[model samples]
Target: MASNTSLSSLSILIALLFLTNCQAARHLLEETPEVESPPHPTIPTLPKPELPPVPEEPTIPKVELPPLPVEPTVPKVELPPLPEIPKVELPPKPSIPSIPKVELPPVPSIPKVELPPKP
Candidate 1:
């Protein structure tokens, strides 16, 4: 019961605070007059400074090179012929035996069951 009363008092205090804030806001909105703001000041423009021109690059001289020497030719040597190899005969592979087939018995069927009617 004490907690309930404290909760109720807290809720009432919050409601009163909200109502007072709303009333103050309504008074400010209705009573205050609109005023014009002062214009912004303009800044003066500054002149740009002049710069000196760049100097030209110096020219380079060309150089000449001596000619290369010629290469000498070489003669190829001849080789003797190789001996011929004899032919060889190979044996034939044996055939694999066939496997016999296996037979299995059939599975038995399950019997059906009936339940009694509900009361």
Candidate 2:
């Protein structure tokens, strides 16, 4: 929010500067009618100077590179056979014991709460 305020203030300042510059320019122009009027100072004709031609780019000689050496063939290495892993047998899981059900007594009912009539 603070950034937005600063941005808006900056924009307003720029607009004010632009308006002030325009007003000053208009007043100056109005004050100098004679200078702005007839026979605008003729732009003095300047002689067109001849520019020297650009020099041609030098040609570079092509460099010949030596051929790359051939790679040597690698001999096939025989690896030793891996030993077989022995299988391990696990014991069977034991059965869970059954739990006995118990009978619960019934819950007593709550008595009604009575309120006296308001006067």
Candidate 3:
């Protein structure tokens, strides 16, 4: 894709041209010795040519534009009042049945057995 190079180069060229002109003007000013305008015999002044008077700035009197007609109040759109939210009656929780305790039978004691003496 071609890049927009004209603006970049133009700006750079403009800067260079500006610097060159400035340098040239500076050198001319610095090198030129100050000399007073040579005095000459007085000459009669020429009549200033009449320029048509700068046309009177047309007095565009601030036309009091009739106040912008008040925007007709848009009647507030009344949405049919949202149907009243229904109160939900939640069913009562069923009572949990009480668990019956079971009594465990007592464990029987085991008889001790004597073993024959090992050789």
Ranking of candidates on TM-score, top first: 1, 2, 3
* Higher-ranked by TM-score: 2 or 3: 2
Cα error, residue 47 of model 2, in Å, equals 21
Q: Using Cα atoms with residue i matched to residue i, what is each candidate's TM-score against the true structure?
A: 0.40, 0.35, 0.29
The TM-score, computed over Cα atoms with residue i paired to residue i, of candidate 1 is 0.40
lDDT of 2 by residue, 1-119 (tens): 47988999999999999999999999999897574556767789999999999999999999999999999999999999999999988898898999998888999999999999999
Model 3 CA deviation exceeding 4 Å by range = 1-81
What C-alpha lDDT do the candidate models reach, one value each?
Answer: 0.87, 0.92, 0.90
* Residue pairs whose backbone atoms clash in candidate 3: none
Across 51-119, the per-residue lDDT of candidate 3 in tens digits comes to 887866777778676777777888888778778898999999999999999999999999999999999
Off-target runs (Cα >4 Å) in candidate 1 are: 57-119
Cα lDDT of model 1 by residue, 1-119, tens digit: 47988999999999999999999999999999988899988888888888788888887776667677677767776778878887777788788888887877888888988899999
Estimate the lDDT of model 2.
0.92
Give the range of the ten consecutive residues with the poorest summed lDDT in model 2: 33-42
Clashing pairs in 2: none
